[model samples]
Target: MWEMAPPKGSRLFQTLGRRPVLRAGYAVVIGVLVLSVVEAYRIQVSLSGQHEEIYRRYVDEEEHINTLRRNLWQAGNFVRDFFIRSTPEQAQTLRSQLQTLQAEDADVLQHLAQMSPPSPVPPGVVKSLREFWAVLDPVPITMLHASNEEQYDFIQREIVPRRGELYAAMLDLSDADKQRLRDYDRQFAESNGRAAERLLAMLGLGVLLSLVVAAFSLRHAETLEQQADRHYAEVEEAKRELQQLSGRLLEIEEEGRRRLSRELHDEIGQTLALLQIQISNALAALQGQPSGPREQLERARSLAERTVQTIRNISVLLRPALLDDLGLVPALQFQLEDFQRRSGIACEFVEESVADYLPDPVKTCIYRVVQEALHNCEKHSGSSNVRVTVRQRPGSLEAEVADNGCGFQLNAKGMPDQSRGLGLLGIRERVALAGGSLEIDSSPGRGTRIALRLPLEAQPQPAPRVAAEVPA
Candidate 1:
């Protein structure tokens, strides 16, 4: 026989990768359903056990109460027969047996009280017991002092009748107790049955809800899986486009830098040099001439030297030569030293295994970030001391720059002109490009601390060498 095929466009046709979140949600819902089922089963078992206990107690109490009533009736019959006997000795023997029977009845009543039955014995039962006790107590004393047949006749006529009445009342009391026990048992059964029914209903509802939730979760998972596939495809495409755009942007930036560097070097550099040469020539020509001419040439030479120096500073600010020639640490050291000297701020530098661990691009990013931070500190913070630290750990690199300066409120927004507060933004972007995070902590009148953490690529380990056999 041929195997049946699944319907078209069914869930089975979809791949597992299509909906991870929905699958997770469905798993959670199924777990909750299983727990509910287990809990319901437990409650059902517990109620069943309770029902058995209540049933047993009801039966036992009913039997005990009935037996007590029958015994009391028998004691009444014995007393009546003794009173009707012609011999005093026979009466004495019956009275002793009757006393024993009465003690047994009292014990039973006490036991009943101890049981603390759910329902109390009826008021009629209590009244009957009191009457029986009154009759019995008086008869034991009166029988001992009784003289002859007259006393015996008195016992038969008066005490016997009262004893019969007391016995009947005790029987009625026992019957009332039995009725109460039966009623209590019925109520208990009804209450237990109702509780079980409610529990079952709750369990059924819980199961139904679970099933509904499971179904919804399954359907939702399928939809989410489809959405995830679309999102993944979009993300991959975006990533590729972003990579291409970044490369193009880097190329454009490099070209622009080269053009600017060339212009500064060829135009401004040559002009300044020419101006210096011309001034020197004029100075040489004015030797031993008028004081004014000599002074003018000297002043011109001085101005030309200052112009040359200013141009060099601007070029370095645009792009540092050391950064291009050397590595990041060396470049940062040079920049920090220059800042310290110019600003007359005491700045210390510290490093830990960072020189060999960081990639060149990451190093450049971190260096630039630190450079901007320091510049901001010098311009804004009235700080006297600064400390820069660089360290490397197992998975990342870290750098911090702290300043003992009059810090400003860091939570404040940018200045009115957007151009006035791009320093921190630039630092943040540089760190982000290097796959790092930046945090700034500062308070008014306190110092400012800037921290950077960058993720590092895992270094490949060397292959193990095979051991060579030694000559034996």
Candidate 2:
């Protein structure tokens, strides 16, 4: 049920304890996660700022270049109209429009120059616009003084060629800026990909470290659990052995008591009786004679009789003969009467159909249970009344001894406390050995009840020794 542990002098890890390893693992994982998040956020912010700036620059460049194209085209159309009609009003209008367009182009170029990096306008695009405007500056004035044919010749040679160049330049500038924006987006995408790869690598490293720490910790925990299980098994084995030894000791004790009771009853009782008889004979022999020592003989005989009675009582207390001769019920009745007589506590004994053929062990167990319970009542229960009941069913026998006393509390397991549990434990052991069950119930102020049940089936018993009866 367990994995083999490392050999002695071998550690689960080469360096650092499990706790430190686990802490380091956690720290690494968290640090990696935090850094990854920060990097992602930084990347996002960079992309947003860069995208906004790029888009703004692209839009502005397109707008200015488009404006340049529009103005240049309009100027070309005005020059065509002047060549066709040769009108002073048209020429003046064309000059004023040209100046306004040039001024607008200049302002746009200045604004583009002031924009942030990656110059939106190519270097030569601005220069070409300025030179084209310079060449067209005198075209309107020339148209007013020149003949129609000459004007047409000048318009075609100067205005038409410069206008085409400037328009083409504007188109080229738009295309260039679009290319720059595409390049910037590609570069940003590559940077984001590289950052993601690095973050993933860090996370993978952290996960691997965490798994190592977890494995170490789990192995250590399993080791401790195995050790605990071994210890528990040893304790349980010791307890079982102790219980068997205790049961053996109790049987030996009972046998000793029985033997001693017999010896005292047979030997000492005979001796005292002989002494009493001798005194009676002596007194009879001295009858009718004064100063015959008859009074002393009577006193001696009285003392001898009392001594015999005392020895008989002691014998009964050690091992009651009624238990062997009259069966379990009579023995229990006598015990209860004796208890009441001695303790001055009221005791009631109730019995129903208890058989004469009960197994000796069961009888002993039941009697001992009652004996122990009554002892507790006298010593600890502080009670005024006690009750004992024994009943026989088809297959079992049940008994109870209860007291209306200031009962004591039970332990967490609802068993007697250790300090007071010796007698109760002994009773339980006996009952268990007899294949029976016992229940103890009590509370602080209510009362105490000890109930027992024994199976009627014959249980295995040790062989009994043959013994002689006590002399009457």
Winning model by lDDT: 2
Best by TM-score: 2
For residue 27, model 2's alpha carbon misses the true position, in angstroms, by 4.3
Please list the Cα RMSD from the true structure of every candidate, rounded to 1 decimal place.
Answer: 14.3, 6.2
- Tens-place lDDT digits, model 1, residues 400-442: 9999998756545422124545788767756665668888887
lDDT for each residue of candidate 2 in 1-472, tens digit (9 for 90 to 100): 9989764323634455666766776787788778778877887887789778778878888887788789889877866776776677877877888889889988887877787763567777677778777877777676577887787688788877787877887887888888988998898788778877877887787778777667766876886799899999999899888878887887888888788888888899888999899998888889898864877888899999999999988987788878877778788888888888889999887877677767777788888888889988999989998989888776788999999999988888668778988888778888887779888899998999999999988434323323222111
- What's the CA error at residue 432 for candidate 1, in Å? 2.6
